[model samples]
Target: MTFLKKHKNDILLILAVLILAGGFWLYSSFAMDKGGEAVISVDGKELCRLPLGVDTTYTIGEGEHFNSLVISGGEAWMADASCPDHICVNSGKVSLEGQSIVCLPNKTIVSIVGGEDSGLDGVAG
Candidate 1:
């Protein structure tokens, strides 16, 4: 009882922080829509563009230097990669605008782009 009274403010502060963080995470995940394209690149040069709303798979390179890219359910993930660390393959899915999967050893990048409203009226003529 004494401890609770003494540390009440600190405990409340921690809970408030946790709640705010979780709210931010939930908002970012659900409120933001899927991006326009998955723009893949190798060594800083664009390799291809894949629409986010479409489902597709791509083998990114040749021989031992390759990454299997999959776009499904409005998200992109590296299904497989030839990079030494395999970090790209484990990167999970990216759907929000500007998210990316980067394979440093393979010099490959898969990035998401779009989701701006473009300042146009919602109603079409």
Candidate 2:
């Protein structure tokens, strides 16, 4: 009885800490809505806005024999190319920040930047 009396507050405090941690984890994982537009750009300017159910095949260069590629479903990835190494083509769909699909032979980079209203400064403020 004496031990219980002495450590009652400590036990309650530990329980409270655990509950708070679990709540925070749940909120961060599901409560936040992170879905947004997929923007492709070069040098800080917009290039393409790909929406759902629509796709476009892009030629990578100016020459007559230049290779081509396609971006589909708000996911711009390397679809096809003429380069010796198909690394870029196999990079897969990128839907998050700092993700990119690049074709080295054509000097073309298909990267995923954040949505218009989603940025570090905007969120902080």
Candidate 3:
């Protein structure tokens, strides 16, 4: 008891440090679990950030699609795609989690970004 009384200030300091560390840990865990916002942009400038699970398509100009690319039915993709291999005709849509479609022939990569990612998609940054 005498020793504790003499070191009371030191004990209080240690307790304060522990409490601060615990609080910081809790805040970090909560921030990680909430899942940050999803943003779509080009060259760091944001283009659009739709709500989770919303389907929207962005079309390219005539020269953008391809040399002789003809899309009779809308000619636009589904904004997101969900395929095992991600190599399907309509897999170009990107609207859901872990959903992506790539056109190898055209070197086109369609991917979904933001809102709780599994940290598995290699292409996503």
lDDT of each: 0.85, 0.59, 0.43
**TM per model?**
0.67, 0.46, 0.29
lDDT of 2 by residue, 1-125 (tens): 99989999998999999999999877655654432344544445566655422467666555532445565654556666667787777887665554567756655566555565345335757
Worst lDDT window (10 residues) for model 3?
Answer: 67-76
Candidate 1 residues lying further than 4 Å off, grouped into runs, are 1-33, 115-125
User: Which residue runs of candidate 2 sit more than 4 Å off their true CA positions?
Assistant: 1-54, 64-67, 117-125
lDDT of 3 by residue, 1-125 (tens): 99999999999999999999999877755544322223434333454444433323443223434211122231224332232333545554334433444555444443444454334233554
Task: Report the error of model 1 at residue 44, Å.
Answer: 0.3
Q: Which model is ahead, 2 or 3, in terms of TM-score?
A: 2
Question: Cα deviation in Å at residue 8, candidate 2?
Answer: 45
- Clashing residue pair totals per candidate (backbone < 3 A): 0, 0, 6
Q: Which ten residues in a row have the lowest lDDT in candidate 1?
A: 116-125
lDDT of 1: 0.85
lDDT of prediction 3: 0.43
TM-score of 3: 0.29
Q: Give candidate 3 regions above 4 Å deviation.
A: 1-55, 64-88, 92-94, 116-125
Tell me model 2's lDDT, rounded to 2 decimals. Answer: 0.59
